[model samples]
Target: MKDNKQSEKDSSADNVDEYLQTLGNEDARERRYYSQEQPFSADEMTRLVNEERLNALLAQSDAFLSSLNSEIKDFNDEC
Candidate 1:
């Protein structure tokens, strides 16, 4: 019974060591990838952010205009 428990403990420790090794390998791979030059420059990133903001604003404006148009049509119909 004691031997069985020891064997289980040894197996669990081995599994933990293997899992830690795998994690270390993944971290090294990620570091290598991030160390490379980025695909987008700072200026390009800024432009992309500004363009996204503009698109969001345009979508909001369109929604507001559509709602206003509907309201105006309903008022006209009631008149």
Candidate 2:
């Protein structure tokens, strides 16, 4: 598992190692954004949003939210 993670990390680094291979373009005519073309379809987005693993993050209990809120408030007061 550690080797797999290291391999994945190395692959990501190699992907990003190119010169100006990410984000923007030098030519205004070539410059574009993801907003111009949606990568995922609406159905895909809906499925992703409704995924059990993702939804689990939003399904916090009332007690958890209360504790989190108290901690946030305490931190704010301390600051």
Best model number under lDDT: 1
Query: How well does each candidate superpose onto the true structure, as a TM-score?
Result: 0.45, 0.34
Top candidate, metric TM-score? 1
lDDT of 1 by residue, 1-79 (tens): 9999999999999999999999999999999988996788888888777787789999999999999999999999999
Tens digits of per-residue lDDT for model 2 on 1-79?
9999999999888878753454334343354543377588888899778578666766666668989999999999999
Give the Cα-based TM-score of candidate 2 against the true structure: 0.34
TM-score of 1: 0.45
lDDT of every model, 2 decimals:
0.94, 0.74
lDDT of 2: 0.74
Report the lDDT of model 2 for residue 20: 49
Tell me how many residue pairs clash in candidate 2: 0
